[model samples]
Target: MAKIRITQVKSGIDRPERQKLTLKALGLNKMHATKEVEATPQILGMVRKVEHLVTVVEVK
Candidate 1:
């Protein structure tokens, strides 16, 4: 399976609870934190939810 690097570029201080949970669901915590996860439909959905707070990069 391939991996994707998800980097948190913005703060979640004032974000909605749903979006905050989405970040946690993506394995991200705190600003500038990054996590590598498999490219899956669920991940894509989460990314789309909080796209403003993160940057996604393809990783092998």
Candidate 2:
């Protein structure tokens, strides 16, 4: 299975609760935090929800 690298590039202090939860679900609950997750649809959806608070890079 393929995987992606997720990094908390920006803070989510004033962002919506749902967005914060999305980041947390992706294992990036803090500023500058980085996590690697399988490239599954469920994870992708979560990332999309918090796209504004994080950066994603493909892991080959």
Candidate 2 overall lDDT versus native: 0.86
lDDT of 2 at 6: 92
Runs with alpha carbons beyond 4 Å of true place in candidate 2: none
Best model number under TM-score: 1
Alpha-carbon TM-score of each model against the true structure: 0.92, 0.91
State the lDDT of candidate 2 residue by residue for 1-60, as single tens digits: 899999999998888888877777777777899998899999988888888778899999
Candidate 1, poorest ten consecutive residues by summed lDDT = 36-45
Residue-wise lDDT of candidate 1 within 1-60, one digit each (tens)? 678999999998898999999998888988999998998888988999999999999996
Predicted structure 2: clash tally: 0
Best by lDDT: 1
